[model samples]
Target chain A: MDRRDFIRTAAGTGAVLAARPGAFVRDLYAFQETANLSHVEARYYIKLPDREIECQLCPRKCRLGDKERGYCGVRENDGGTYYTLVYGKACARNIDPVEKKPFFHVLPGTAALSIASAGCNVNCKFCQNWEISQVRAEQVTAYDFPPRDVAAAAEANRCPSIAYTYSEPTVFYEYMFDTAVEARRRNIRSLVVTGGLINPEPLEALTKVVDAIKIDLKAFTQAFYKDYVRGDLAPVLEAIKLVARQKIWLEIVYLVIPTLNDEPEEVRKMARWILKEVGPGVPLHFTRFTPMYLIKNLPPTPLSTLRSLRKIALDEGLQYVYTGNIPGDEGENTWCPTCRTLLIRRNGFAVEENAIKGGACPSCRNPVPGIWA
Target chain B: MTESLVVIVRGRGVRSRGGEIAPAVLARIYERGLGLLTGQTGAEEALRTLFAPSDKVGIKINAIAGRELTSPPAVTLPFAGLFSRIGIADRNVVIWDRTNRELRAAGYALNADGPGPRILGTDTAGVGYDAEPFVHRNIASRISAVLTDRVTASVSFAILKDHGLAGVTAGMKNYFGAIHNPNKYHDDHCDPFVAELFDAPPVRTRHRLTVLDALVVQCHRGPAFHAAWAAPAESLIFGTDPVAVDAAGWRLVERLRKEKGLPTLAEEGRPPLYLQTAERLGLGRAAEADIRLLEDEV
Candidate 1:
């Protein structure tokens, strides 16, 4: 749909337009005035000679000249110092169910104060939220929601967690990091939903502040990452390993596109890799893909493809393999991997029943790996 | 087999001893350059050969680097004034960039309307990017309404600079300002994206001419202005063939880089390979042999 139609529909639905469900819509017509951008100094960049700076935040270590922005289009180098133009400028904010972030293992069915800024490090061809993610900071409307305000909003909204989502959180690293720190002070958890294109130093530092991270592993092969995602699979794999090694909770979501990344063999290889590196206890979501952005030529992924991929991961010894986007399906529920007992039953984003007690299956007393209250 | 004409006109006293542009001399350089490139005797006739009297002309400039390296008013205004000589109304011509902030930083006054040769940026309210993306091969970007809806014809009046990614930012790369997401195209030396972006319908159809402002060429460490590496070429390169004009500008930057004892853009592994790709796409001539370069002094 065109932007005007999208805006009209977004205004009408309010919650459906966002990445997460139950997300309240703000003033969709308030496109930011061109001059309305933040000038906060950025971190993780080294100043070079001739008023240039090298951004070390993502795998694309963009070495930029003065007044030049990085690939993310949010961070810029201004006369030897780098600054983020999106700091405290949230383009999208909503109160969503934590299940929408699909963090099945972390405080499921609770509300997460989700936030996003404009810009992303990688250019995924089929990005669902490309309206906010693909554009630069100046292209989108943003609100002046600072870190303390975000924490306060979460607490005021009675949300137990705050989520950095919609766009790639790595591009808006400072805002997410500071907000996570502020949320921690308020005893609210912070969750990160990312493409996992971040550097090791920043990802490690991020794990210290956040409660859990859901990394969208787009595909298995480097070729797919290169051609379709415009990123590297190696770094995302490295990030997964690093995040799993940390004290924080981790989950993986693989968006299976039809005829592009839906080979059973590739999915099998990825399942085996995750089983070997991150272990079977970590949840692996095989999400269905809809035609969006530049990939309009392809059809929405078949339900059978998602179910089969989930079976492959499960067959490869993954304990928590789930299928997403097809709500109310039997794959939406969490089953006890040990005794085949239903632990938590879900319909769409809603939690219908919980049979797990004290993080263990109620029937067999098998420890279910999750953050259960 | 068809030869593209690229005119390089050097005005010796275009810049004053204090390093300011002499508008009269710069005007003379533009007249000579356009006259030679279009094969027309008078400046008015030269412009008439390219633009119709009733056409809305958009002069897209490069103002990302601020005033130091942008297409200065001393250079651009006089050129825009020539459109008036050809019977195109002053209000029908606009000199614009990406944002009003960048335009103002480059010393351009904000003139959405009620002005001569209306000067403004794409960020002006009601003049933002098109609601939908202009999708083409390897390119899907929301183009500025200034180019898509307003202008009937366009002139890529760009500044010449050495880019870190694209190797050379010239007339063809100037259109990057017309799109919302230029940062996404800087991969792999901007090879096919730059060519593909220019080949997009919004640009390939409306684009009529290219005029590279080489008055103060940022031959090295640019797209940004590093004074230590900048050179005063005091010349304007003009051509109707966008690819050929940029290829000439790239050659000029390489010459300046060599004189400064800097490594060539190719040796640095960042040549403007997009020119060749553009040529392959039947945009224009890219190779030096295919371009018939005509040099003149004003």
Candidate 2:
């Protein structure tokens, strides 16, 4: 059988998939069926002698031999030149609501033309999209969506912004950067959804193009990053700092697993850090964790756990703290910090109402920080 | 504890500058190596000692480097022919690798049906990785169905080369192709991960032998083929002990590198620590004192 047929058969038997969390059970996305990989030469790599290259894309700095791929599985060192096999080769694409990216602060109530290629820099144990993120470029079926075509598709679909999402966009830096550049030429905004595991130079360059960036800050502790995420927390923290310094919109999402990262002390520490470093205006989302991929043993984060964490962040003097993955919760809506009026009411990925006018609270005229234009 | 036995069989003109491998010379090398490895008087007897007549044998070959540096068809096909001579059906024997494209580039005819030896790849239609991951230490990866489902016994028929990270790629490192996420295990010079992966049930329980293709060894800057560094070793190395065979292969690469006036892999800070890791796991011998070397001429 072909890959498509094999997946279908496996799905019918409930043999291929791990136990998914509740939110994923309600929304099952279909896998694409065309493994059209690209061989475009990558950016942000250092060519070494003897046909080896050091990838400077993420913190891994993977020094690869000729014909060897990096940890990301999408980039390879071919005869001393590093190339991204997923460049402009999108494996997942859809017009998702802007809040699904959890960018409540940017372009609320608008549709985002979201796209992702196969592979990610970090291997998160609880990865929801492991079928795409954990495979090589050739393993997944992908489409050849070039930068110009991506920009055109976003414009044609009436999406106000293009989101580089679903999988980590850092591994597809060249594709995302060029696509953002093309989108800018058409007066369309570009956004990024990432794990923030990129190097400073590339992250700095990317901020100049993308209008907003939603960083999934998995956890605060280095142990959590090393064990669960297979990445370093310092670089992500550094990336958050760098993005906040720029004019681009920045938001952080921390997935609170039940027993892993939901401790009150750690949550308070993270909230205080955000308050000090990134300021209180930046939206901090406490998204619920799901049982997926390698970490299938853990249960979903409890609502009380999420609510308590949100209370701690708000109590720590953060402005726009929100809870995610819980439909019809009051925390899903954005309440103005000054007047306590709901600026944007959201349920799941759908927006019920948006009350902000000219980037300020409609009730008290308090200057709420966002890209509302 | 007995020393692990490794046989090195050589042919004077096994490889030509025109990229042609002498099939007759390769056949002799395979015969001698298998005879010594199994303590058998003949090739067919050696095969009988290693596998049952009802067993489906999978000869997993390394073809990631394409035609330039891979397990040559000239060498592997003759080896498969020996299994057929031992009363194992040709349909029960599979000569396979990771992808069909790599197998085709390595000059293998893609044969899955109406087959003699069932030459194909893991990516062939109706064949893919196992649905669930085989979670070994530091590795959660999907294994190719050819190894997990199709084969009862496995032979790692690998091309020996100087790896930029692992210091040497031989029998043990060749199994990296069997997993879906080898890219994740390359860090720390592939130490412990390679050994740990081999210790996983799918590979450890079924593995029967290791055959190293040393005819055209890439001694420097490989896993990839570089003409200046590629040396025609004109030999095949065989053993039941995966670590000992790879340890022996490392010596060959170091010898070639020394001849070219380059630093040893140890001096370059990239020794194949996985061999020692494998030894610690009680998988096989890695040290010279624990390995018995035997040489023969074809």
Candidate 3:
């Protein structure tokens, strides 16, 4: 077809032409604006001979030649110098509820300045936000929200914390690290909502500046990680261990897909592992998974599955296991583990009530582990 | 049955030391490759057979490696010019890659909407990656607007080079540039990912030809430019089957490595397993017995 005819047809068939189920290419597509990606020299990388460089930031350890990009697609080796293409390049910016970040333990009802850039190290098959995470820096429309500017925007918008969310924060490590440092200076807290797919050194460094981290532990088995997430499960487990060891408030979320990862045995094993590794006090959220991306063949997770997984975690002696994405469910509320009283009554992205004084349950006077100010 | 006959034409003087392809030699290389592949004596006759008059051709080149190692504009533009000569309009032929920056860095002027076969990248204002991903077997990525919207038929005018992960980056792997997330598939020696990405509809459906510019091959430690490892072996690989074209490119790189006493890709632990997977998927044959390689001195 001719260019004019193609555009006319594309425009004419705009809403009717849906991407057929399991089809690889599309008839109608929308090209995003060019994201103004940065090229600043990156940290946590070593220069090698003949302009080659090795990235030590993540486990991938991408050994790149001059002009080649890493697995993250944001970092490139520029004539023996490694540079990050997403330093302070905020591809997405929004003011979301801290509860939306799902930090129920921390400041419950406050707003968080959430931001992220394009690109992720791992490709999750059930990615709800693949438009941002699964694309290169240049494929999105981005703004120049520098570290200092991010802090300023958060403060200006009355957000208590700056959240490195939407996409994987690990991919935009430099931006997150710098932004966290700047937030610390302004007395604003830093929270990272991630899959915990990170190396130790970077995680250690990130924890030093951030107040809390919510790790989305996808499944219990390495097989699930390989088949579904295209990433290793061990590094994520290691990240959780490191955060738990660092005295950081850590929470784990498991999106219960229908048949793929919602097995009771898997949930039980995961609960036991969490109980052993991070202790019984850590909150574990069994989130309901929606059918999206490559895994659209299955339906959304059933309420029964979420409830069953939650029950397993509670039975495993895990103190604070909850179900998410189900509005107004009792699992959305944070009941005091010791006293069995609602500590933080939550519905959707709002905190309805808080029966806590001095960061402890009012009924039992048990100190709850959170950043409640 | 749709018979896809691929050809590889080797030329002696395609590369000049000043980093420009001698256009005369390049035109001859194209003629020889197309003639043998299409069984037509002339370049126009071969291209006319391959492309319908209504087909708007897109020549996608790999230009991320800069001028030292990229599909030179001299080689690709002349081929785009050939499409026009064979009754395809100049406005209909697009010489494109992922971004205009890489094209400019590799010494090509960026011209998307203007005249003369429209040279540009996917990152142009009206042109960018598709908002939704083209979800294929193992690959899910946002493709370039040029491919999804503008072009009717596509040619992979890619540079042949050694990749740290993929073993060799040639015509088949060149479609990585057509997507937004090529970097994500570089793991596991680019096994399954490379083949899967090509099997994706955006690439496989539109892809009509594969042409590798082997004038300056990055023999070792590449997909990036390392002067010490780069070879001056003046050759170009052409084919209709993307699988066979890349396989020929791999053989050329292996030949260069053996001459340099360097370790083979297997010894280095980065073989292009994607070709084998592609073969299994019935895209094309990756085996040596399946390929009919035609070499010429031009």
Instruction: Give the TM-score ranking, best first.
Output: 1, 2, 3
Off by over 4 Å in 1: A1-34, B17-19
- Top-scoring candidate (TM-score): 1
**Model 2 chain A weakest lDDT span, ten residues long:** A24-33
Model 3 misplacement above 4 A = A1-34, B1-10
Task: Name the better of 2 and 3 by TM-score.
Answer: 2
lDDT of each: 0.88, 0.87, 0.83
Q: Which residue pairs show collisions in model 2?
A: A1-B126, A34-A142
Off by over 4 Å in 2: A1-35
**Candidate 1 lDDT by residue in tens digits, A1-373:** 3334434433443343543311211122124344458999999999888888999999899988888899998998888899999999987877778999889988877988888898999889899888788888887777678999889878877789999999999999999999999999999999999999999999999999999999999999999999899999999999999999998899999999999999999999999999999999999998889998788999999999999989999999999999998999888899998889998899889999988888898999999886775
Shift in Å, residue B263, candidate 2: 1.3
DockQ values per model? 0.45, 0.38, 0.33
What CAPRI grade goes to candidate 2?
acceptable
Q: Write the per-residue lDDT of candidate 3 for residues B112-158, one digit (tens) a residue.
A: 67789899888776566676677777777778889989998999888
Better of 1 and 3 by lDDT: 1
True lDDT of residue B62, candidate 1: 91
Interface RMSD of each: 5.5, 6.3, 5.6
